[model samples]
Target: MPALPDPLPDPVAPVVPLGQDPGRAAADRLLGQELRRCREARGLTLRQVAPVIRGSVSKISRLERGESPPRPRDVRALAAFYEVDAQQMRVIERLLEHAQDAEWYEQFSDVTPGFLKRLIQLEGDAEEICVYENLVVPGILQTRAYARHMVRAVMPSAEPEEVDRVVELRAERQLRLMDGPLPRVVALLEESILHRRCGDAQVMHEQLKHLLHAGDTDKVSIRILKMSREWGVTPPYPITHLKFSNGEQSELAYVEHINGANYVTKPRALDDYRNALSNLRNAAASKDESIDLILKAQHRFGDRTAS
Candidate 1:
């Protein structure tokens, strides 16, 4: 029988290198995904990769799932073991460099659930984000007062401090809409959602005003689905579609449920959500019409306060 190729010498976890600054959670995730693909492609399992990387199976699993960052030397060792060429080697190195940075949201780790952490990671790197809101305004476009009302309403039993923390976290996320290279946001809001009394009539009015201002920006497009329209089926879930521009340029659909969230990656499922979003866009009011509707709703809310 022909001799089998020898595996590369066992590796030690290299001194983890750091990036320019924090906020590399997204990069770490992308790198982990690439590592998993390489491992699976070469018919290797977590158990097999652990020894080579000088880690346990769980550690390898975490690295593969982007649950943890990977060391540069560990990445190099895996590349060599997989017989990756010079070009691929460089790619791995690039990913390792990206994976080294800390996440900005790490401070909220105590309050943030793992599922939400994953969502935030994806949100950080998304080039475009599409959100469908059935009840309230999408969090990314919400004003502080509106978001605070939402937090209080949803978690009525939560401590005041916790609610405040949640509101603060939401505010931080909203900054993404303008702070840096903005993610183009396409938000579909049900018409009745504007009328749903959150904090008070004044609160709703102020929120609508905020929405109007946000919609005016070139990066945001808000559309309202009228109540009278014969919309087919109500969306079974709130959908968030994230589109990325760099690396593999992956597209993901985040479906939120009562307890947790589901990430849709299968092509067919993704297509379904994509098509639904397209249909919703067509059925909703145009940009100008949406702005007009929002203005009308704001006036109505203001009227309630006057009376």
Candidate 2:
């Protein structure tokens, strides 16, 4: 079996769930996986295919692992090496081109492989982000220290270098909202998110201060769904929505537990999460009150709240 990625690490920063339509990415993933299978079926290993492609075993390994794109030359070489027909190679090459043009995220192949990088690009390019958090702050609101702690928590086995890379990637992801015409951001969080301290008190304080600023921004909103409210119906799950400038929208969600993570992207699967966020808006504290809640959380850090 492919090695399982490290368990759900605490996010260094909050990432609004980006529901990427994985049609092409899925197809590309299948292409790469299929290519690997074809080569294996031919009783050839990377060592065997290396000379034909004028590459090393590691390059072949990367292609098979879906850690990198299969170059056209590499694809043609491998296809010829595997005796695959021209028609199949054409399709694979097209997918490979799309993969190379990835626009969203690039640093998380360890956590997300192959076409997933492309999906992240589409999500990052979204015009609006609607997120519902069951626990903790969103990535955009997390301070660097808190974000690093979160990534490290679930990746205890990751090499120090890998952990730092993930932390750096998380920080980069958080920079999206600051650029371009700022996207609309609507975030709903369970009250407990305010209490969880993934980092030192100072880190939490900085995070809270950032959240307070976000709440005041016209482009951003952070709302709290406190436990004290008498919510008539419990939300079935967490959900996130990404809307494009053209009005295209997609919802993505996932749940994490002791077993691992179960991602949800289907429309029917995502409805409850969206609804839950909607319900929290009416049930939780007001937007203004939520801002105050975040202020209180940040104030817990020290005498100087914002600096």
Candidate 3:
């Protein structure tokens, strides 16, 4: 991976409460939404704004869709072009500032992929996170040993230092989410995850125990999806749906694949993931039942370790 530019220092601003930095990605999306609204309200199109910003139509579109970070000059130009009021410009400026601020995950850019970095930024800004996993426990719910083992298994070629950095990144992300009051997390795990051993029996036992403890929290919900013919097909890849504090932008659905991930924002696509999550929830065990299942799995692993 090429070297990434160092993130800008955090600007001195009012301290935001935990789990609420409006995150770089979320801020970009919010700014893009505002810019798009301004254009539409003025009966303008991307073509008209492209020239004003000295960019292409696609560039304007990317800005409007929050695909790229907004440049201050371009934002100012567009604000002037749209003749937005002082208050609106202030809001735009604030969003721009937030968007430019470095994300927490930037420190791990060497180990983190671009798509995963975006997900981490969104996670920080989300008010609620819904996760569905079939392969293994979600990163936020994984114990350190489990995380280390999983990382090594997945990235067989990674150096020891790189592996440690990746595991450290996961630990930091887990800490930020679990140590906060905001960003409620609901995770759905396929029962196979419990049976699929990532490491030694001891590691699996410890991981299951950690899941039980996480599920006991007020802000976290963990449910086990059982393997039954009645439930039909399950999503092949992992799905993460993030609902942000800003109500203006729509919810985002993330699908992770081997190479990269897709961010779903279109209503129809998002609805499909939402429906899948809802159906899985209905088919899965309740919280209490899930706890029982996890306990059983933990004991199974514990017995193996004891032997």
In order, what lDDT does every prediction score?
Answer: 0.76, 0.65, 0.81
Question: Which regions of candidate 3 deviate over 4 angstroms?
Answer: 1-102, 303-307
After superposition, the stretches of candidate 2 with alpha carbons farther than 4 Å from their true spots are: 1-101, 111-119, 233-237, 247-267, 305-307
lDDT of 2 by residue, 218-285 (tens): 88878888778774654444445666664334444444444444454556545655565566666768
If both were scored by lDDT, which would come out higher, candidate 1 or candidate 2? Answer: 1
Candidate 1 TM-score to native: 0.67
Count of backbone clashes for each model?
0, 8, 0
**Per-residue lDDT of candidate 1, residues 1-307 (tens digit):** 1221112212221112222323466667778888887888899988888899788999988887778767788878888888877887777776775465236566777667766767776776678999988888888888889988888887889898888888888887777445555568899999998888888887888899889988898888999999888958657556888888865437877776666667666666677777878788889999988998899989988765443
The residue-level lDDT of candidate 2 at 16 comes to 28
**Model 3 TM-score (2 dp):** 0.67
Residue 112, candidate 3: C-alpha displacement in angstroms:
0.9
Q: What does each candidate score in C-alpha RMSD?
A: 15.5, 12.6, 14.4
For lDDT, candidate 1 versus 3, the one ahead is 3
What is the descending lDDT order?
3, 1, 2
Q: For model 3, how does the per-residue alpha-carbon lDDT over 129-221 read when each residue is reduced to its tens digit?
A: 999998999999999999999999999998999999999999988987875577899999999999899899899998998898899999999
